[model samples]
Target: MTEFDEILKLEIEARKKIEQAEKKAERIKQEGIKQAEEVLSQVQKEVEDYRKEKQIELEENIANLKQELETNFKLRVEKIRGVFEHNKERLKSIIYSVLGFN
Candidate 1:
């Protein structure tokens, strides 16, 4: 073969090798991007799940606090009613005594 032909052949082979290396590098980069996306998706899902769980827990806590407040209010009302009834009875007795009915 001529020297020019040999050089041309070498140049062609080098170009093929360079193309192959570029294709390999592109494939590796795509795979890395795919893995990173998957990891991000998983993390996002986990964060959403955690947020939902915390919201549920907060709702439960709020419900329990409301129940406690309601119970305390009812107890306070009962005590007030008892005191009012007692005072009313005493006033009745005093009126009866003053009227000479007792």
Candidate 2:
């Protein structure tokens, strides 16, 4: 073959090799993107699960606090009632004397 024909054949082979390399690169890039998406999806799910767990824990804590506060309030009210009952007779006597009806 002439030098020109040999050069043309070499050029054609080079083009074919370049095309194959480009195809391989594109496949690798697509696989990388797919793997990254999967990782992102898994992370999102894990974050959601963690958030839900924290929320439930917070709710339980709030419920316990509310219950404790209610119990304390009831105890305070009972103490106030006891105090008033113990002083009710004295209060009545004082009122009667103040009105000049002693």
Candidate 3:
């Protein structure tokens, strides 16, 4: 072949190699995007799960605090009631003496 023909053949082969490299780069870019999307989706799901778990724990803590407060309140009320009961006779006598019925 002539030198011109050889040069033309080399140019054509270079272009084909460049086209193949570009196609490979595009595929690699697409695969990277897909992997990034998958990782983002997984992270979002994990965050949602963690939030739900924390919410449940918070609700349980609130319930326990409410129960503790209610128990403390009931105990205080019972003590007041007992004191009132023990003083019932003294209160009645004082009221009667003030009304001149003692």
User: Residues 1-102, candidate 2, lDDT per residue (tens digit)?
Assistant: 999999999999999999999999999999999999999999999999999999999999999999999999999999999999879978988999999889
- Candidate with top TM-score is 1
Q: Which is superior by TM-score, 1 or 2?
A: 1
Worst 10-residue lDDT window, candidate 3: 85-94
* Superposition TM-score, candidate 1 onto the true structure: 0.85
List the lowest-lDDT window of 10 residues for candidate 1. 92-101
Please write out the lDDT profile of model 3 over residues 54-101, one tens digit for every residue: 999999999999999999999999999999987997899999999999
The C-alpha TM-scores of every prediction are 0.85, 0.83, 0.81
Per-residue lDDT tens digits for candidate 1, residues 1-102, read 999999999999999999999999999999999999999999999999999999999999999999999999999999999999999999999999999999
Ranking of all predicted structures according to TM-score, beginning with the best and ending with the worst = 1, 2, 3
In order, the Cα lDDT scores of the candidates are: 1.00, 0.98, 0.98
User: Model 3 Cα displacement at 12 (Å)?
Assistant: 1.2
For all candidates, the clash counts are: 0, 0, 0
2 or 3, greater by lDDT: 3
